[model samples]
Target: MRLSATSLEQVPPGIARYSYHRAAQDIGIVHFGLGAFHRAHQAWYTDLCMDSGERGWAISGVSLRSPTVAEQLNPQDGLYTLTERSGGESTTRVIGAVREVLVATEERETIIARLGSPGVSVVSFTVTEKGYARRTGGSLDLAAAEASFYPLLTDGLRLRRERDLPGLTLLSCDNLPANGRELERLFGEWLTERAPDLAAWVAAECAFPSTMVDRIVPATTPSDIDALENLLGVRDEGAIFTERFSQWVIEDRFAGPRPRWERHGAQLVRDVAPYETAKLRMLNGAHSALAYCGLELGHEFVHQAIGDPMLRGLIERLMRQEAATSLAPAAGQDLEAYADALLARFADPALNHRLIQIAMDGSQKVPQRWLETLAYHQRYGEPCPALIEAIVAWLRHVRGDRRPVDDPMAAQLAALWATEGSSGIAAALFGPQGLFSHVWRADEASLARLTRRLG
Candidate 1:
């Protein structure tokens, strides 16, 4: 028999339950991506609000791309387990903050209509770096084909034009720098082109709050399910296993009523710039460097890569040298302490953050984490030996052994590299155009250094 929400008593001990059949009052938030990270971080925060007995802070999960996740989750009655694994011990907590799941692709009109609902005070997204459709220069990428056709074309710009809802806050929990401003510019461009009237309306009303979200949620493995059943004594179809650490920092920008997330561990600040830069540049940038270099070195997972002293040294050097330069305002942040913490997180023997998974979508990632700093160093005449090495490693990853990296931008990088032979790889790296842009095109000496390192 199919499990129902009302069958909580049937659920084994240690597994929490939520009754989907219970009446749900329309709440204040709508989350765009129903990924594992969202389940572990944002949903957990909302659950804390619910536990506090605060009303109107519930969330309606929206999946914009596929129906598979909705199909899997809805049958479980929007119930999911947040499994935390550290060392040899594990804990499980079922999240109930998600009141419902909406498959936006299957119900596009319905999804759009929900945005217009009176109860939805805020619209949030964890759609990763690519979801915003941003350009390399840290602006909204309105030139995308979908920007002309899709309802939100470029991060809800078109939708705001059609509805003109002023009292709405658009929060982005992605890993981009100045994520909120980037969303604004994308929507701004669409408004200037499509509907000037609504564009003006959006300018007057609406909030795009920048955020920094951190957590390590690896793709669920079969062993994880086995462990969950053994520990929780229950079958959980929607369980997400992750590392013990998680953090969220948000700029205080909300319209209408919102949840008191600060009651939980979340930090609410006037400006999220310093926090955002610190996480983006140091943590995420090092992650990218390790992913490319580690994968090329035949490492399968993050922890496995960390096991290699050479790769570990490379990661340390990259963080200490190249990545450190990008975080100007956050310079006071304990670099060594942060690096030590990141190393421990990355080296968690339990979490299997696959190199191939990290290797995917390098095109979307490299621009922010690697190339941006390279450009910064070039413009200001800063030393960047480790950054240059990371770039060389990334180039090797793209070219080496056809290891089947899974990034969406892999094809684009391949095409760019195909213009020249292996020797031309350095030329492309130093090219005047493409994602690297003119600012990052290394001089002959730098190119020679990169070429020598790759060879």
Candidate 2:
């Protein structure tokens, strides 16, 4: 038997199961990129709200390019198991917040209808950094704009406007800096170019709240699925595994009502900048450092990397010193404690967080994770050799033989390395036409520092 509405009762007694009235549920949220991280993070938070008697906020997840997620989820009646593992103990829970998943290619009209519904006041996104289809300088690649999600979002909002419906809160739950603002800017440019008139209405009514979401959802393996079957007494095709720790900090700028996510461990605040910066720099920055450096040292997983004294030392110093020092923490924010917690989370052996997984999108990740910190040091004449070393490692990673460099700019980066001398690779990538979103590049002094360490 597969885990579904029918198999709900068969789940083991020790495992948690939602008792929400699915029949009365309304799919008000339309989340894009229904990936494992979304399932583990945002969808799980909404699931908790449902258990606590919240109504009308069930998610209608949209998998943009692939039907694979839809196939895995829809068959199981949008049912999936989430396992939170810590130390050696694990907890299993069935998530019921997602009502259905729509593959965009197949169900475009239906998705547009849902998006235009007044009841769907929230259209959230967890599309990875690459999903925006952006250029190196953070603007939408206008040529690719038609195929990107923003145009689809424009169609949805246009329908809503035509039907005299109010605008929805456009929440961006990605790891980009000021993600909400970037999302708005990117979409604004796209909308202005495509649907010039709808821009003003969207500007006045819609809300794009910045959010900081934290969770380590490792890619589920076949063994994980088998383990879940043994624990649940049934198979669950959409099973996801994650760490015990999860946090969401959203800017309180909703256009209307939203889940009382704050009641269930989420933090609603005036500004998410401080929290987001800390996470991006200390947590995400160190993550990239670990990814690139760990791969160089023959480490496979996060725990393995952290277990290596040399890797751990570099990351710890990177987080607490290089990354932490760059941030202007808000009142009551303890960056050191945050760094300590991150270190602990990274060291959790149960997560099985792959270095290559974190390393996948180097071109999109490094600007926010490593380059900004480097830029900050450049401004202050401070030394962040830790970050520079990470950048160098990433440069080497982009030219590796073990696996394909899994980045959007892989071809361009490979070409840069193939044509440019390695010693000049640092200068070439940070030069006037550098293929990065960051405005800052290495000066002569910084270039010398980076070049001396590389080929």
Candidate 3:
């Protein structure tokens, strides 16, 4: 018989399993954007809590954009497998931390109602960088503001206001640096424009806890599902595949009740800025560098790029140069060791995090992860040749001659590329008040170097 969520009683041998009925009874957290990464990381932590018989950490997965995820997960009765691959061995665990899957598209009111519920202590988001509708300077993208504001205002925030809901913690799990502050700014901006009174109420009542989350969970494929069935003797159509390493560092700014996530290996700190800077500059910056530069060198996936001796060397050098200088001591980090571990993680052949996946939203990502470090080096009178080269690669990739792939930033970057001249592409990237105003003032020689590299 096919294993259904209802059929689950005890935890399965290879996979952590639970019955649908049992999951339904547990509640405390509501997570937005129920993607693979969230499942592999946050939900995994919650699963640890559930196994320990802890209360107030069970999650309700919510999807804002697509009905497809809800459809796929609900049929499995919200039961999914999390496969962790390291060196040569793989471990499969069925995560039943998610009690329910709700499609906000079909039932927007229902989602808002759930968010407004007194029982829901935390509202966490993993909606990616673009989901915030933010621009480069860590400000709300007023031009693209409606994409997020409309849904949040009408469906989520409005309901919260109407119901006079109590304060709750808002945790953002996107890759953006200072994610908490960014959300605060966005929410503040949206509210000031639409509902000033409620905005003040939110400012006083809610907590936007900044967090640093890291893991590589690629989109699930049929082969992954097949592997789950063959290895664990169970059919899990909604299985998620990821690397073995995971980390979550949270700033303890919660106004309401929160999971003792620390119990499940999550670190609760007084401030997460140092950790955020370390991860963003060292890990995310290097990833962006590899994504553009390695893709330009004719690679399809991150593991493939790491396998190449020359590109691998380039990645290591860039990380050592850029990240080492950018990370602050307060981040409580070891730059060298972190870089070494990053290289090994990227080289994990079993995890297929594609180049295209990392290459997405370069316009939104580069400012925080790469450009900020470059600007820091510039201010200190240091050479950022490798970092500059990565920017050039990004500019070339955006020009559509090198990668030939479609990215969300393609059109905007193409427009920027058209303005490139003997003056330089660096000028174009930095001169734009929209993206890099806070960091760079557009140096002539740097622009010249960028132009020369592109030529």
Candidate 4:
């Protein structure tokens, strides 16, 4: 039988089990994006909190697009296996933090009502980079935005106001820079233009707190599921696999009551900028570099790419020399040590982190991951050789002839590549009207250099 509440007794003794009474805890958080990362990262942290006797913090997960996650978790009674692997060994645990899964399109009213509920104080999101639906400059792209998400959030807030409920904190756990501020600004733009009164109320009452979340969660495979089922003696459809390390740094700003997340290894700091920036430019930037450059060199997984001497050298240089240089010096942040730890993590053989998965949505990702570092170098008249190579690799990868470029701007990128050819594509891509034009439109010298490579 599948791993549902009734099958809890069948689970083995060695595997960590959820002992809490699931029916007693109220749903205090409604998280938007029920992806594997959320299940392995935030949900895991929440599970720890509940185990430590924290009440009223069970999560109600919302899937914005596919019904796949709801289908996986709902039948399992929101009970799933979390396998944390390290050094060729694994530890398994059943996470009972998630109480319900709702497909946004199917249960819009239910989500809104939950958001308005007095018990729910925080509404968090992990909807990936493109899911936020922002244009090049971080303004809300109203037309391109999903009615099920953005407008639905606005309607939810309006309902809260109507019901006289306390303002809820809106938490953004994405990789974007200043994620919390961006969320507030995007919603502010939408609300101000549509309903000015509601905008005013939100500005005064709600909290948009920035957060930095880090964990390496590779997509689980059927083989992995079979292995885990053998260990548990019960199949878990919503099982997730991740590394042993985890970090969550949240800016300590909330509109109302929130979970004591800090009690369970989370950092509640006054500012998350330093931590956020370093992770983006170092870890994420290196990942993108490895993705594009690794794929170009015909490597499949992160462990394989990191083992290659050339790719390893490029990423080390990209982290220590280029990305770390771009960040301002901060107290107690040993960026050199941080770089060392990242390299070690990258080389973990147990992680089957795919290059193509990281390579997806390059048009949406490169701005913070690589382009921002390039921008910083450009400002100081410094050279970023590794970054230049990675950018060239991305320019080549987006042509969409070999592997698929799973991006929202795929058609436009392919059209540019087809129409311009090698002689003109580099200039066209970095030119004023290009996909990355919003972040650092290249000067003539930069264009000429890229053209020479293509030549």
Candidate 5:
């Protein structure tokens, strides 16, 4: 039997089924990019709130890319299992906070209508870094810009404005430095070009709160689905597996009322900048290093990379030395402790976090993860050979031929590789015309360092 609302009663006792879920509750949130992280993190927190007697904040999840996720869960009545796994132990829970799923390509109008609804006071999203369509110098990529998150967001907010509905809180749960502010700026630029009036309204009424969300959700494999079936004695097509650890830190500012996610262990802080910078530079930066370097050395998974002595050493140096230069920790914040915890999480054997998965879209990731820190290092006269090495590894990964690079700029980069010499290619890549800041292009010493490493 397939797991569904009707089959909830028959679910095995070992599975942690939600008892407080109600289909009749009004949906108060519309989340975009409904992937595993959203399911395991945000939806899990909302489910806990429902269990604790908060009933008005159900989620309507919208998958932007394709209908694959909706196809998997909609038949199950928006029900799915989330298995939290650690070494030799796991716990399963049925998440019901997501009351509906909509495929944006197929249901764009419906999504806009939902976003315009007075009942939905929050429009949260977890679109990855690439979804922002950013250029290298931390500006909006308006040249190749097509239909993306900001465009859709503009249409929805315009609808809300037309309906005279109050502005909603726009929460960004992606892993970008100052994600909320970055999103607000990107959306503002786009809106100003398209509709100046709506842009002003958004500037005044909408609140784009920065957020830091931490969770290790590996891509669910076929074997994982089989394991879920064995554990639950029912088919759960939409099942997801993740590590036991999770954290969410959000800026307290919002345009309107939102779920008291703090009540369920999320931190509501005055400024998420410190937390956001730490995670992006230390955790995400090291993850990219692992991805590019590990792939070059034949390590496929995160644990394998961390377990390898050489890769592990580079990652440690990255967090403790190079990446730390730009970090300003609050009192009682232990950098070493945070690094230790990240190492432990990355080394979890039960989690099959793929290096290639992290490696995807390097063009989008490198700016925030590595280049921004590189800029800080240059400004402060900090040594960053480890970061340079990681950049070399990324360059080699893009240049060499084990698998096709999955970046949006892959074809353009490949064309450059085919045409240009090493110095020329490096110059183009770090040049003003390319995806990097002009300062990098002008810094001959930095260019020489990277060229030496690449050679």
Candidate 6:
């Protein structure tokens, strides 16, 4: 048996599952980057809302790059299982909020048409940071912009404007700091050059609310699929396994209607920067450090690395003493408690959060996760020993000294590393055009500490 609408009755017993039987439900949300995280987090939340008898918000997921996700879920009638594991306990739920999956390569016109629909009150995206085509200086890369998601999104918005439909909320669910404002600037710049009238309309009408989404979603392997099948007595190609923990914090500003995500545990706040900053620097920063350092240390999974007392100790100091110093005290937040909880989450053995998986797109991830905090320390004349170690490991990883690199800037970085050799790699890494351009390279004391620690 396969897990589809027809086979819902056979989805094992005792699992908390539901079916989307609302015939009048329309697509009220369009999402870009239909990856595992979006499926596990946003779509799951919308599913919960529907389970509570909330109508609308059925998602039409779009893939900007390939058709792999569409290939996986469309056959099963947009149905897939989410297995949330915590410690030794696990629960499976079949998600039905995803009404359809469309690929840009196959249905660009349909995507544009749907975006212009009055029914779609939200245009949300989980397109990774690299998809934004943002430079280190927070400026859009004009050449790369044309080939990125921004252009596609602008086209959709243009269609909406021409159709005279109500402007939708442009929600950015990526990990970049001030992600909503970044999208606002990105779309604003593109529109100003192409269509000035649309730019003014977007500025006056559309809302780009910043969001903080936290979940540990690992890449699904064949073993995971087999295990899920054994549990449900059905094969589900679209199944995803994730940690039981999840969070969604949104800046409470929307142009039009949105799913009452607050009804289902999402935080809607006036300012998301404080929460965003704390989570990015502490949680995301530690994850990047673990990825680079753990990969260098030959640890495959996050649990394997975090389980080690020594590595865990290093991470603790990084979070509490180093990264936390740069963040403003968020109201009602226990920074130390959050740090401890992060370690527990990282040490969750059930979800195999691979180091290499987190390590991919290092060029895109480092600036926000590691360099931002390091820059703060340098500005204050303080030392950041743990962050330095992570940077050294990243330099090694990008240079292919330890493992295969999977970054978009891999070719450029490899060429620089090869030209510079061991003696010059450090300088090249912190150079003007490198990923760590904002990091201090002239501070002799910090450089010495980095050298001593790296040695």
lDDT per residue (tens digit) for residues 330-364 in model 1: 53557668778998999988888987777767767
Query: How many residue pairs clash in all the candidates, one count each?
Result: 2, 1, 2, 0, 0, 0
Q: What would the per-residue lDDT of candidate 3 be over residues 326-346, giving only the tens digit for each residue?
A: 767564467788888999999
List lDDT for all candidates, in order.
0.73, 0.89, 0.76, 0.88, 0.85, 0.85
Query: What is the C-alpha RMSD, rounded to one decimal, of candidate 1?
Result: 2.9
RMSD in angstroms between candidate 6 and the native structure over all alpha carbons: 1.7
- Assess the local accuracy of residue 241 in candidate 3 as a C-alpha lDDT between 0 and 100: 88
Question: Which has the better lDDT: candidate 1, or candidate 4?
Answer: 4
| Candidate 6 positional error at 168, Å | 1.2
Number of the candidate with higher lDDT, 1 or 5 = 5
Residue runs of model 5 more than 4 Å from their true location after superposition: 142-146, 431-434, 438-442
Could you tell me every candidate's TM-score relative to the true structure? Answer: 0.90, 0.98, 0.92, 0.98, 0.96, 0.96
Which candidate would rank higher by TM-score, 1 or 4?
A: 4
Q: State, as a TM-score between 0 and 1, how close model 2 is to the true structure.
A: 0.98
- Sort by TM-score, top down from the best: 2, 4, 6, 5, 3, 1
Native-to-model Cα distance after best TM-score fit, residue 15 in candidate 6, in Å = 2.3
Q: What is the per-residue lDDT of model 4 for residues 27-137, given as tens digits with 9 covering 90 to 100?
A: 999999989999999899889888988899999999997999999999999999999998788899999999999998899899988888889988999999887888866
Backbone clash pairs in model 6 (N, Cα, C under 3 Å; residues 3+ apart or in different chains), count: 0
Worst 10 residues of 6 by lDDT: 433-442
Residue pairs that clash (backbone atoms under 3 angstroms), model 4: none
Q: For candidate 5, lDDT tens digit of each residue in 1-455?
A: 88898888778887787777476678999998998899999999988888888868889999887889898889998999999999978999998888889987788888888888889999888888878877756667765445566666778899999989999899999998888998899888877777787978999889999999999899999999987788787899999999999999999999998888899899988888878888888999999999999999999999999999998889999998987767788666688898999999999999999999999988887877888788888786666878888988898888756688999878877877777757677777885575576434426777778777766
TM-score of 4: 0.98
RMSD (Å) per prediction: 2.9, 1.2, 2.5, 1.2, 1.7, 1.7
Local error of candidate 6 at 48, Å?
Answer: 0.7
Off by over 4 Å in 2: none
